[model samples]
Target: MTKRRGERPPVPEALPAPVVDAHTHLDACGARTPEQVREVVDRAVEAGVDRVITVADDLDAARWAAEAATWDDRVFAAVALHPTRTSTFGEVEQAELARLAGQPRVVAIGETGLDYYWDYAPRSAQHEAFRWHIDLAKRVGKPLMIHDRDAHDDILAVLDAEGAPDTVVFHCFSGDLPFARACVERGFVLSFAGTTTFRNARALREAARWVPEDHVLVETDAPFLTPHPYRGRPNEPYCANYTLRDMATLRETDLGELATKITRNAERVFGLRDAAKS
Candidate 1:
């Protein structure tokens, strides 16, 4: 991993506590039951993360994510049909998503957007499904959490034309400085994940540096992009500290300031009003 300026190298024991993991799939992280969720969450909480957003990318997973969120105050939900799951969605899928959105626990409408990496679904279907997710967010009065892969132009065009929720976030943002600037201009939030810590992610680092303090957010996208030093192992919410620290260093800011800003950004973008009450 490219070491962030002043990063004290990867020593898990030396990291700070009480960070926020803005995006993840608790269920997909190999945790299938409530007890399992608690185990993972316990580890994260012990590691100092205050909350974790568990994103569901499919109908069943959405329900599971919502249940997990409802069961634990530390967890929040993002519900939608992922780009690859578009084929499974139609009238039934849409109705299910809308139903799930009605639940207070489901704060956002995504983990949606385009993904050209695998092209698991047809491009046309991906666009159509993506539009549905965008409209769902608008209708539900929640911010949108997008997942774009090698489809920046298309994603931007769709968001520009379709209009987004009051708050829009590029989850695990994968774009260069120009895209970051454009998103900032449109008042969108850029969330960096472990990819930002990759040794080759100079473009992402530049974007991180340019993003406004309030507009920057960090996440682990865990069970996936495990940050360096733990890159080969399975990632979890606690690993987000690496991302938070990396973002702080990349933006040339204090870790405390960056952590606070990102925590607030997560709350703002997700429409989370009651961290404790919920």
Candidate 2:
């Protein structure tokens, strides 16, 4: 419909700009609608975070993640059925997930892996689904975004058996020093999230130190795990600063240097440079 002559023209608001949000869940975090995503992205860009990789754990959420990338220049996506959703995977599901993998905005193949802590699904199912995702990642030539929760040993075993991708990342890394050392030695990227900012998360701090500079990345995992100073509140990409600052302190480096290194690491692991222009 054409606008009426007497109607005021729409005024364009300046973009807040963007930074690199390694991982998040815009759809699950109440950024369900495009407008909500736009508002959050605006705040994030204003805070110097331009791009965010929105991840999803199920088919519906996966579609939303992909749609989010379509809605804004600041958003990208990762699709997979999380470990807890192992029961949801089936022949049809795998076919659909593979179809989503072909989407241009879908950059990685995960948030998938083992999680013994919750055990929402059987161990065998989780293991099988994990292998499926790894195979899909390899077939699609995309990086694997892993989620290991109290199941690091099993996760590593399977990844090794399945021949993990050349570009693999352990998102929201909360492992002990030994695990961190092993991951770094294997050339796997470890992404530090808001959990890294907790004062009492000493183990994570130690693990942060163990991750090599080039193998380290940062994320918000927003609407959850809000970092310190904003703890007990909702998380957002804008709050990534707290975790980044904590990481800088952990590595005894300047914040800018840490950010630059993490950004580079994200690009290398996720093949962000190969994505279509936002």
lDDT (tens digit, per residue) of candidate 1 on 1-278:
33353332333542453666889989878888878988888878766677888998888899998888977788888899889878656898899899988788788888899988986799899999999888888887888899999999999899889886788889999899999999999999888898888878899888887888888778888788888665556788878888777877877888876777777777777767753465
Best by TM-score: 1
Candidate 1 has an lDDT of 0.81
lDDT of each: 0.81, 0.81
The Cα error of candidate 2 at residue 235, in Å, is 0.5
Candidate 2 residues lying further than 4 Å off, grouped into runs, are 1-19
lDDT of 2 by residue, 211-268 (tens): 7788888888877787765566667776676677777777898777677667777777
**Residue 189 miss distance in model 2 (angstroms):** 0.4
Native-referenced Cα lDDT, model 2: 0.81
Which pairs clash in the backbone of model 2?
A: 18-49, 18-50, 19-49, 19-50
The true-versus-predicted C-alpha distance at residue 144 of model 2, in Å, is 0.5
| TM-score, structure 2 vs. true | 0.91
